[model samples]
Target: MTRQRKTDAPRAPESPGGWDVRSEELVAEAAVSGAETAAGSGAVSGTEAPAVSGAGAGSRPTRRGAGDPVKALMHRHRELCERAVDPLEIAAGLEAHGVTDRTAARFRHRDVFALAEEMYARVPRGEEERGASMAPPSRRSPDLPAGWALFALLPGVACGLTVVGLELGGGRARFAVGLGGLLAVSVALRVALRFGPLRSPHQAAPATRAWVCFLLAYALLGDELLRAAVAGGPDEPWAPSLTAALGLSLAVAPGVWCARLFAVAARKRLALSKGLTEFSASVRPLLLGVVALYLCALWALLLAAGAVQGEPAPAGAGALGALLLLSALLSSYGFTRAPLLTLGAAGAVEAGSVASVFAARLPGCDWIAVPVEEAVQAWGPGAVPVIACGAAAAALLLHAARVLSRASAHADETP
Candidate 1:
């Protein structure tokens, strides 16, 4: 049997976190041999990470050579790395400590994620006593502000009273009230989401932001346009469907509630979890349950709104609402790209469904819209958004379950 070489672990630097070694040279000499092999001779093989005392907590590591700058950071945050469930958790902690991508670049890393990966990999994993693995409550950042969920009711109540006012008033006054109510409800929604778990951690690009707006506009106008197309061309000016608007408006409260529930439950489960596998096992079910709860609430709201309007439930608008909520939830947790892509795709389908109607008017091009025409004829225009956004919502829910279950995703989150 070949005898294996084992090096003693590098001692940590003496920082406020109680590190002991306080020298990057010690870490460089004691770091994994694989690092030297990868970096070659020019690396920080025996170099030191000079630390200036009293630089506060956010000091940068100044080291010579090119091997690995993460070694110094790893030691400084030794407690964090050893306790982290994975690299993502470490990344969150780093970001919370004011480490940004530009700061990460000083370490020759692409971003905080890359720097975190190196640090996580360099540190040796140690087993802790049962339940001791949970991060301190302060570091285990919760996202929902106190009493934020209560704010969700404002939008729904404002819109509901507006709908009632529309019924009581007549002629020009009713039109004016309807327009004013829409603006009021819009403001309430913005305020409600601003303080809740509904706010995304990462702001989406302008284009995807427009996609969400388009989905909302489509919710009001798509049904009327599709119905008109089905009835052989537009014979009158298009009007927004109050049911669709009301359904979308009412969805805000449930979405905020569901988001708050998910955030609280996930953080609780994270604290109780002993390992990554255990956290995933417990949190995934909680995510699905929250999603189901939201769907149930939304469906009931849509049904009631439809009943009030003396029409069938706008199932399509409900689907779009579900999609929007799921996307926002995912984005709030730093999983921005997935939700943006999914929402963009759903918007494309809705836009195409409407465009196909007009495009089909050309000779020899009717086949291009055959599927949409058939779907609209058989199930009405609601079928288009129902199919599109429903699929997107399901896809997002599945992705959310997988991504949000990670202990790292919730690390350093803020209320």
Candidate 2:
């Protein structure tokens, strides 16, 4: 990711004394909506919004008459409004909770921005901006420092050098070189996920991560090996696709960068917007632009792979790479559900196709492998991930549009 210029780096909004803006937001939402109170050491615990006590949410009485929706919202977010520096800050806060012009109409306001304006004016803040609130700085920097971009290259360079060593090494030396290459790739990937743009709060479980590992391993050996099985050739299945492995390894850099760009742009859009519809309008173009940039990067990398190897990559490798990059983006953004399932499904299909070709040698199951064998003869084994992962990536693109466009999707974002 390009380092955001210093001047463009987002400045933290000056907050009122007594409570952190984030803490206040959490407290207010809980007290008003969930009827729960937090007890803390500071003034934060004392300034909670009022709600029915010792009663279920169904039994709680409305705080305002049916005609005045503003009163209800104002009451619900009282703490947030009182702590806000400006109406725009309140507007951003509301929009983060899925509020919009349409919802605001019920409150008799022209838009969310207008509703926030009224709320800000109504709250009485005796001491608004004396200093930073009790909380430390918000964990919200979207920019990845240029140093990180440089660091992102470390893995690809190391992987490339190791691959060169593997190609040059012979006999017993090949094992050592391959082991070192795996180590280098692993450490570098950990760095990308640990601090750079690829990190997320909601890490997948180990069981889920098995699918990711399966996809990477399959990318390296699954295609060529499957073809050998289809032809009934005596080729070694363990003789991996070095170019495909390189493609997957080098992907870490651009994947981290694209995610960083998307996050920075999304945060900027969230702040400038007044309504959800306006924000969504802004998100669509940004999403497409980022995806286009990623595709270009992928194309360049694929070309580099072909040049280095002295042989062109399989046409289907492009589809596999796209699916892998999109899955990484989705995981980084906390939209893990679809990506995990897609990865698992794609890996399963590849493995199942291979199994079917072998299963045909069994008694009555000769026809079981016919479909796979014929398909391989018709389109090559690369068609498996090309079909499965290409479809998965398309489905994920749709999922990303629907969820990532929402401000709340990134509400819990960390630096």
Candidate 3:
């Protein structure tokens, strides 16, 4: 018999572009080699046959450079974030660039998701660095009284003048009291927000500074809108519309400023939540209380103005209603505990306000007949909507008070 020649097993076919060799081919070669080795030893071992099969079944052909795409995607995301690009905008850009859901799945490695999380995570340190670099050097010590304390008294001054004017001032004086007080308060708060927070105890907390900016913006936008409507004397029909439009246009600055502050606050909040930075719990309640009280007073004065005029509820009434709802909704996001409950209370008030608006607009509603004082009291049988709003407002104030008290207690406890 001719002697049989043994040869080495066949190798896997190499893929082009350095891609992984075919897994099935490698498995087949392994099985054949294992079988040959087993047969050569003696009788073919059963364990050897199953072992080869298991090896092939467990083996997977890894995609060539699977990590490269994920790394590139994460890098791009980080770049966009650093440049202050919105995540949604980044997502849109990715879609435009043909980075689809399937493309993401194609790179399905655990590291991919982890890397993506890291990519979007807030860089609080970077924010602090940017804020520090942009902030002008202290022209004076933040503690040096910048006359901002007087701005704190503006609300009380405006309120006292309003009460006195309502009780004794003539029609012209009442009008002046209403318009001038609103103007003074708005201007003072705007200036204070711009400069005050950057001074004194507030200077240390960038988040609080941002919070003040948001408050100033919100208050100014509403007040300016009201002023625009009222600036034109009641006799001048066309003037009110023009003035209103101008006011809205001018108010855009505060609106933009507020939006920017919100973004900053969100960044800071994310950093705080992630435990990447420290944030003061005590200062938040004080800031929130100041804003809540300011907004409440502004809403009250607007209501009072509408009452004094005996005219149809000014367009500003709607603004107050909107503010009420917004305040409720925003309270959840404010630096406080039990935000969900706060959200629900605000939502209830908002829903009630909507219902009232619809009810008031319905046929024969005769909202005009309701006296302004009674409406403000919101206590009569027909004043359910106003009552609900007032109650919500009261609850919000009380909650803020509770928060402030808690913060104060904590502060006293601390060194």
Candidate 4:
């Protein structure tokens, strides 16, 4: 309030047309000052000022070129991304970016679809693309052959039925219906298994199964035969019936197994032929030695049986000699042709008959009362040793022949 001279504030400069020059100048100065500040802070460059208009200028806090913010942000982001994105960093970034809980949870769980979508969005416009339909289809099943399935069930059927039949019948009937049913089922199953659609005829031949069945039947039949033989007397009616059954079964068994062998030989013709040749070559000497021993044993046995009957040394020896010769001849013949196994089998049958006849005659001998006397009377106590030697020889010869036959058949099969 001292000397209050009306000192008007320094007036702003004037402009044409009575405009408020000071206000306009002030606005312009403020804009220039802002631009300088922005430039210093690196938000914009001077060259971009002319292109920005009223609204655009407001939108952009400072002048900038088209790619400026994007380039700068991309550089900054790349630097930040170079620092590994640990779980903690990811969580922090999510929080800082104000990401929703659901979106953040998806990121934390590493959802593959979310990741793919993010990658697709981040890629600069035009790049190679693919769709979900390109993925391969899933496989759900396996393949198997039909023959294996069929063959695998045969053993189960046979064993199951056999057990059931045994439990039900207990040998009351010669052939129980249940046992027969089981056998029938087994045969049917075997046939089906062998001849199933996927099996080869050569591999599934029914003759093999038939042979096995026959062997089993034959063994069963032999028990009946032995029973009949033990029980047989002039007055026994059942003995005759059992004897007949036994004879029939015994007669059939060898033939059936032989037939199966023959079928196998025929199927593998070349192999069998080769095997026969090789077998014959290897076994000739061994067979001769065996035959000689078998003859000696047979003669000794006959002499002992004759001595026990109070007969002369030469009485039964001739017949025994004939039996040995027959066996050797049959065995030799059978080796050349597989059917000969049957002939040899028949010879064995004849030998058994001869032994039985001698055994029946020996009971009335002079040495029947005393064991020592019997031993002496029966081939003079040398009968056992001689018989043992003969048996050993026969066994060796038979083994040699068998081996030779198998070898020859095998050799024939080779190329």
| Candidate 3 residue-wise lDDT at 379 | 38
After best superposition, candidate 1 residue 368: deviation in angstroms?
Answer: 1.5
Task: Tell me the tens digit of each residue's lDDT in model 1 across 1-415.
Answer: 9998866433334443223344444555445334424333335444554444442433434343324545656655778987776666787677667676667666666667777777766664435632454545534446356778678888888889888998899989999998899899988987897788778666677877899888988888888898787667889988777887787788898888788787777777755654455667898888888888988988898888899999888888889988988888887777788888988999999989888888888898888888998998898888999999999998988888877876667775642
Overall local distance difference test of candidate 3? 0.36
Q: Please tell me which predicted candidate would have the highest lDDT against the true structure.
A: 1
Question: lDDT of each structure?
Answer: 0.75, 0.69, 0.36, 0.33
Q: Per-residue lDDT tens digits of candidate 3, residues 1-415?
A: 9998866333322532222233222334334334323323433211111111332343222331212333334333445434432233333234444444444444452222232343344322355655653532211112223564444444445544554564577768867765775576566544543443211221223443343333333333433332222232223322122222222223323332332333234333323231111222433544454455444544454555445444333343334333333342233234333333433453454344334433554588747324422443453222433343355555655654444322111211011
* Residue 89 alpha-carbon offset, candidate 1, angstroms: 5.8
Clashes of 1: 3
lDDT of 4 at 409: 23
In model 1, how large is the Cα lDDT of residue 83? Answer: 74
Global Cα RMSD, each model = 11.0, 13.5, 17.4, 36.5
lDDT of 1: 0.75
TM-score to true structure, per model: 0.73, 0.77, 0.31, 0.24
Off by over 4 Å in 2: 1-68, 77-98, 120-146, 233-238
